[model samples]
Target: MIKLLSLLALLWVYMAVVGATHTADLSRKSFPKGFLFGTATSAYQVEGMASKGGRGPSIWDEFIKTPGAYFSFFKHLLEDINLMVNLNFDAYRFSISWSRIFPNGTGKVNRKGVAYYNRLINYMLRKGITPYANLNHYDLPLALENKYLGWLSHDVVKDYADYAEFCFKTFGDRVKNWMTFNEPRVVAALGYDNGFFAPGRCSKAYGNCTAGNSATEPYIVTHNLILSHAAAVQRYRQKYQEKQKGRIGILLDFVWYEPLTRSKADNYAAQRARDFHVGWFLHPLVYGEYPKTMQNIVKDRLPKFTKEEVKMVKGSFDLIGINQYTTYYMYDPHTSPPKDLGYQADWNVGFAYERKGVPIGPRTKLYEEDILCVQAYSNWLYNVPWGLHKAIMYIKERYGNPTVILAENGMDDPGNLTMSKALHDTTRINYYKGYLAALKQSVDEGANVVGYFAWSLLDNFEWRIGYTSRFGIVYVDFKTLKRTPKMSAYWFKKILRKNK
Candidate 1:
């Protein structure tokens, strides 16, 4: 805990110093000509007035309202929505909350919800900025969670198709780019296995060891989510292709996994980790099936698809959205596997966490000397920009050079500083510089990377973390609802202008 605190303190100081002295040579450092630069946000995170939009309660609404929840009674969504639209966002990527549109998750269209997003979308277009929209971002209607198996149920595939069709029909004419889902793995893991985020339910001990639902839920949800994505893609291709001429795909969050040692055991462990993480989604879309290693490891825990289903899922996407953050080191150690055959065993096959070496340079303070460091806000996010480049390269090699759009990537600072105050965020600027350089390298090496969208446009509700961690390029003053563009925002604008 002290180490974490020290890391945060160093980050704050580093940002303060860098923000003061940071200035890029716009002539020397610029993005490729025509590369798109933008910022992203999610619906549940920024759109408040959940009840006003003919929006029925989502699991998030219920989760936040729980007695001891972090965002309970916190109305920061409207503030964020207003700040995002009224601020200096060139291209804004956000999601349409499911329950907000179809109040009960199925049946009727929520006119108020439709009006709210229509207003937001039109507002962005009026500002001369294109709106990149996603259909779902980890928030399911409470009604759906109650009636169906959530993503765990196969029925969700059709229901999700219906929802996607509705959105494409309603907004596709204006919104050119559409994402089917955002980081489904995180949703499945948090909702089912860990029970840390929402719909918290941890499986009880059956015989001797405690089991986690997350282990199996992902396989189940992936099966459904992929089919749902395929169905949506099918609808788009058949119904709206000639009319809208829009592109649709899924946003996959990937992390580069490296073996700790050159030994065969460690190498094999690293391979297993990669297949389990990236291949979980990529395989179904690319190869029409889940990773073979996942099936070999988890055995029956993974869901099987019929031949027809595989055909439906395989080769269905028009593009792939990569959302990478950090890298993880994998090591193999001699140990017994877990007793149960559910989720915990997914990574328990003598696999252990290994830390990677941090680069030593003038920015060493931000770079923890050890492999595994702490994040300012989320425990899972460690500061590692190099991983982003490696992830893009891996996608290129594995998926046959698919046109990739970096959907979400950014740094999170602990300080509750607004954009006006975050001007001194040198650490963040450096972080972006390093990652952007890596991405540029990937493009030069033939990665077919087209655009980059920073993780967020403004600081908003960070799900379970509430609004504690800020990843916005433009800072939001929660109290006054003021939006201020940070130095990074200025730097991004310069990069975008240079590219243009």
Candidate 2:
């Protein structure tokens, strides 16, 4: 609680400094017509009914519950929809739990699971909230993981496509915007490289994970995820999309990399960070191959796609969803390459929050009282709002400004914050204000960003961090499952109303 108060104070001071320099004009009227403004949540994160209604256990069930425990959200279905209506949000981007849909990985359909999603979708539509359905977040079915090691095996390409096809056939009619996967890079990196996330896999050099070859598994997992994504896109284009008239895409997380100095080494290091982060996925989808920096560094450890896979993966999406939250400064430390190889080490660059004793932005404050969003737990989430501007501009300059969506952008507070303090949420409001101003500036400069969705709609279970982090605009009392909109939620409601 003291930490929360300190963060709130630091954020207030930062906002004052930012406001003095760049007056943010973030009214909804700034966006073009048809620009989507909404919030998001995933099934596993929010929908708690894990065991009932014929739903099978996901890897998260096995990993989080540590032995596959169950939970439920069935009773709150209508009440949640009613809450969305009250918020006056125009859209909602959520995910479908794979284990809930096909409990045993691929053979049989869970009719109860289907009915649950159908009910959720029907009610959202009835309440006039457009649904942007993502096929997968990080919740892989435990059955698949046990059978074929999940994403590491080529077998997953067909299995994932088969699952995606089931979804398209069933819910494509209602979901106009389809995202194949959310943050696959995070899935590969956090899950396989550091073992910080589910399934707990990492090389011994990286973490105390039970079993994983971080050097090799991250690359292998990413290759299969890319394949799975392309296959699903192909299925949609070849079969359902023509009839359904809906757009299909994938969600990627990007953190803008700024050079610590104007020196050539720092510039190159920054490029390498961007290449290893965004280019790891976007490059393949756009140019049919890995970025030159990645290709040169990762070498054979990075999987290569066959001629058929290349053609299928390229131009795989009608639009791309980028989840941007923060930025960092990268510099070449001139360090020797290590014998132990892992995804993070492959970058060959050093990260810094400051240079010459000056912080990158006010958000770089790491003082215990001033630290925001995971504190030093995640130093990368510094409040560099201009980074969003740079990120969108980078996409335009490099990737041809293809249709884009700011799918996820928000910071978290410690979950133990008092209810009154949580409802105030001035820091979160300022986060939206500053970031949206940056986004608006990017759009004004001819960046073809068409939509923006805040990182989340409601506070629920955050993966790994679990209930320890609160990133939602709406507050949920876990003890009673009560919903309370924060000041930011009311802010969005008012601004969104003004534009409409």
Candidate 3:
């Protein structure tokens, strides 16, 4: 009886403290009339019934199975689909692992795979949540990756269009928002150029210059990806849009680049970085060609498109989904001739490595120090909330403020589940608060920012980082496959309820 009384007392104090500290009522901030507030996940990350759905192997399947693949430590894959569907997400954004839909990536349709996705989509709809489906999310069929040079081969574009059409025909009526690709830049750079991701191959090292091969492979892959996206958009516009009344767009992941010193050189370098990162994809979709900066920077290193191709690429999206994480500082070259004058020359500029200029929060210097960027389980993710705000503003200013959906954004930490899973996650909470506040500010300033979807709904396979990093608001015990919502989850739920 005494212990129960004490527990009640503590809970009361906790609620009082929370009320005092957090002022933004999520319930009051209900998304713009028809706006969405949900969480997202990917198929390969959460759906572990890899072999059950007649789903042929994806690059992830092969990558994860490799002897010393980064995430091999978590042998807890092959999770049950029933359990995953019930994981308690407001809304879930996942991909249709292409291999699962077309086991061979082309001719035969995998009925079992189709049924599995149908089940998942039906379950979400039944739960009163929307299903934001992506046609591809980094898990290309291994057969395509090997037989065709994946996205490098223009044929894969047609194959992808067919696959996308299949998805629309199958799930278009039920799913309202369809994303053509999750993050094409990451696919091209990580999978093709850096050789860190699956089908890992450095085009420069291989010297496999087939019709589509060159140092320009990343740009070429992007061009084909754009073509594939356009084909899907065009098909949906013709066949499904009126009947389905759904929206279609492609999700592009971007990192904001700022000039380290406001000099012409630094500014030019920063612009170059943005052009390569965001413009490489956006310019093609919006303007019918790649950015002139990228063209000039890469010179002949990028592939050229005919006039007809340009027409096909432009104005192809109903909306643009952007996934932004961090911002970087750019530096100018000291030498006369720009360092390498190669495709990747601009990335040589320095970054905002130290947290000197970052804005501050109420409690800690960790929040203020621009030098102490939040590190992802993967070295690539450096956290900068203001970067997200800057990114949204840039998109609004540069691209005529298209309806922007923040498709993915979150931080990751790898440690035992303890207080870290509970109250101590102020870092994650602060990150969201700061970024959301900035997003809210953008909306107030007339940027057409429509929605924000946290990067993950649960902790699952984090690609190369494997299960080492946990980014989910709900803690998933890999051993038991039990999901316990973290404090952040509770907080976000409150925010959602208030916003609603």
Best by lDDT: 2
C-alpha-based local distance difference test score of model 1: 0.71
Model 2 lDDT, full chain set: 0.85
- The clash count for each model shown is 5, 5, 11
lDDT of 1 by residue, 24-72 (tens): 5532235566566677878777666666647788877776784222221
How many backbone clashes are present in model 3? Answer: 11
Tens digits of per-residue lDDT for model 2, 1-500? 98787778776776565574453456678898888887888888888767777878888887777432212356777876777677777788989999889999899999988998899889989999898999999999989999989998999999999999999999999888999999999999999999988788999999989999989999999999999999999999999998999999999999999999999999999999999898999999999999988888889998999999999999999999999988889999999767899999999899988779866655543445324332212345677788899999999999988999999999777788788867877667777877888898899999999899997888878877778778889888888878889998898877777432
- What local distance difference test score does each model get? 0.71, 0.85, 0.71
TM-score of each: 0.85, 0.94, 0.84
Query: Sorted on TM-score, highest at the top, how do the candidates line up?
Result: 2, 1, 3
What candidate 2 gets wrong by more than 4 Å, as runs, is: 1-15, 18-25, 66-72, 363-379, 498-500
| Better model by TM-score: candidate 1 vs candidate 2 | 2
Error of 2 at 50 (Å): 1.5
Q: Where is the poorest 10-residue window by lDDT in model 3?
A: 361-370
The true-versus-predicted C-alpha distance at residue 83 of model 1, in Å, is 7.6
Residue-pair clashes, model 1: 5
- Tell me how candidate 3 scores on lDDT: 0.71
